[model samples]
Target chain A: MNRMSSENNLDKPKEDEIVRIDFAFRKELAEKVEGNLASFCYQCGACVGDCPATFYSDDFNPREIMLKVLYGLEKELIGEDSVLWLCTNCYNCTERCPQDVKPVEVIISLKNMLADRGIVPKTVSRIIDTFEKTGRTVQLSSAVTKERAKLGLKPLEEIPMDEIHKLLAPAEEDSGK
Target chain B: MNKFAFFPGCMIPARYPHMEYAIRKTLPNLGIELEDLPEASCCPDPIYFKSKDKLSWLSIAARNLCLAEDKGLDIVTNCSGCTATLSEARHLLEDEELRTKVNKRLARIDREYKGEVRVRHIVTVVRDVAGYEAVKESVKCKLEGLKVAIHYGCHLLKPSKIMNVDDPNDPKVMEALITALGATPVRHRNWFLCCGKACQDEDIPANMMRDILSTVRDVEADILCLICPTCFSQFDHGQVRVGKRFGEDFNTPPVYYFQLLALAQGIQYENLGFNRQRIKPKILDKIETTLSHA
Candidate 1:
């Protein structure tokens, strides 16, 4: 991993060299200082040892992902076409993390970075679009809405598309900064 | 009386109207005034987290906080996700570097977050202002013989420092509230499980249904009391789908904490939106009689 200078400029990396990311961004993003507990992981596989999803699918391994992030292999960490999306953010890893690496938040931060680069998985993109288009994520098939109405509940209101666009306008404008 | 600018989030008004109704009806009796901030949009929870746009997420939440500050009141939210987002954004904005980055973006909308307002979950307000003794006094009925399970949804407890609601591992506020209502709050395994909202990104319906069923079965409680909209939707709607999946009769109980409070307040089940639930008819009947007698 390249050592980043303790400076605020985003253009510190040489043309051919990889950018050395600092813990400040992680602290700013996570709202807590990166304890760098990731450095303490010895690849004992304790985290992956008990992960339920790892047993079912080879694609999901919390320990491997944390090691990649810790090694500053951002390319491999975020570029992989794996089921990192399957992590439920269950915090089982956080609870069981011997080093308190908080792989849960680390994965969340990594996913956030990938998402900003427009590399979100397809299904995840669709959910985001649904939330963007409609204020609510749960799209009750028309039949489900009717069933709810029959049960005396008001049909889920279609959040006015214009209102959603308006709400998003600020965030959209913010990204340029 | 403490005055709070209330951000109901979209769920409380549209789908879970009874939650709004209950809070509106009950808080005044406890001397807390909840004033709604008009034109508040969805907290943009799914998009912000999924997109990993921390600045944008913070800006949106900061915008809401600024709106509340303009009204000269601290913000109180009924949804745990909203509380988490707003509170987290407030903390981020307090940092000079983060504040500059976030506000530069927010400046486009003419909203600047000064971090003057405090964002709190409704449960925190109840525990802080009303106190257990006061809540006990407000209870018109005791929920004796009612076996209740408390679901402290993920956003509320996790990231514990920001929430500060209770000990994340063993939250006693919701349990204390249930116990105050005179119900037996049962401790269950997996009580702290995520409602699988995060996993819903992959398989919209399937994962949600499975997560709800597994957790409900793990807990095996008569009724589940929740503090957030996402959890309520998952358990309420997911129970319906899960019952269809296994063909095995699975009728797990679910209700909002406020609904139980409404019942204790002698409010009618219909008024409390019990009829709006997607649970088995048998469970609804039991809740109806329980509230009616209360």
Candidate 2:
């Protein structure tokens, strides 16, 4: 059986197809994720079997993401319209990966990289802004308070925004202070 | 009675306060005392917040932990997202370097992650700490003959090294809890499938939820019982949307495990806010009828 002649021979690249490894991007991801778990993935499709996103979407696959990570394909993963957000962060991939790749963490690091570049989705940005402002993602409206009171639950306490603001300060601001 | 710092997270308190009401009413009866954690922020949401800034997420989660630590009590979280964030943060901060890094940020708020307390999901607190026997004994109205389909969701039991609540693949915690309430926990197809609430794409979560709902329907379960509020929102409110999208009637009512416990422990059905739910649990009617006949 000549494996290269088979119809499923996409693994065997043509003479013109070349994957450029962006080592710098890989280093950046490594700095974000401790031990660089992405490097451990051996292309086992275990992560895909249980992935809800992969089951529904043609574009999203954790194994493929890991392969791209190995090749240091940062541009493909961290853009505004990247497929990374399709991930539910379920950690099923982390559970099923035989090599302990923790593909979800790798994808999250990629997401963090995308976020660092200010390419956040509007919904996620709203949550971030809300958290920064109120020290909670969902605002406590008067209606919410009324409902709690009806349930005999205690009234909502205000989070210390000043303390949260200090923690949310940018690196430059912290250093400058 | 064991005392815990109750970390309700955002969704339960802000969106599904009834779940909070049920927990407050039930846990005290089951030998667990709830002390509210003052000034605790969002577990900052484990997904989007972490995606934006890992350090800030870790710091915010640690700050929430500090609220419990100051009270010298372990934390019990109702939402799976909060448990995952706090547990994973505790697991990561075990590394001296990361702890120091997080502490550097925490020092800004006059706090530190001394790793003094443990973060536990409310389900684990009910099962492991309070024991299933206590649950059975506390039941004034057993959910007898009710078939419950269990949804463990994702964060409550996954990334085994960190969450460590149960076997992510073959978890029996939720089922055991359900059975203790005098209901039969039906093992439905796609039992291990995530509720897909966290998936951003409409089609992905819709399909994922449709798969789970279809299985729950096949099992003929009276209600889909779950621990996470996010899953509750999906199967209860989101089910209407998913059913409409897929053109199927997924009328399965979703009930939080604590709500079931509150009901079984003799909390009035009306007081628990079932009326506010999108898809009302028909089993509650049956229970009410049975109680009246008795």
> How well does candidate 2 reproduce the true complex, by DockQ?
0.63
Looking at model 1, residue B251 earns an lDDT score of 72
Q: What is the TM-score of each candidate against the true structure?
A: 0.77, 0.94
Q: Which stretches of candidate 1 lie over 4 Å from their true place?
A: A1-58, A72-76, A79-81, A91-102, A130-177, B46-52, B200-220, B280-294
Task: Compute the lDDT of residue B180 as modeled in candidate 1.
Answer: 85
Q: Which docking category, incorrect, acceptable, medium or high, applies to candidate 1? A: incorrect
What lDDT does candidate 1 reach at residue B73?
Answer: 93
In model 2, pairs of residues that clash are none
lDDT of 1 by residue, B103-178 (tens): 6666656677787888889998999988887788888767777777777877787667666778877788998888
| Cα lDDT listed for each candidate | 0.68, 0.86
Question: B1-294, model 2: which lDDT tens digit per residue?
Answer: 899998999988988888888999999888999888888889989887888878778888889888899999999999998898999998988988778877888887778889999999998898888899999999888889999998888899988889889988788898889889899999898998888877777888888888899988998988999888888888888999988888999889999988889888888788777888999996687796676566
DockQ of each: 0.20, 0.63
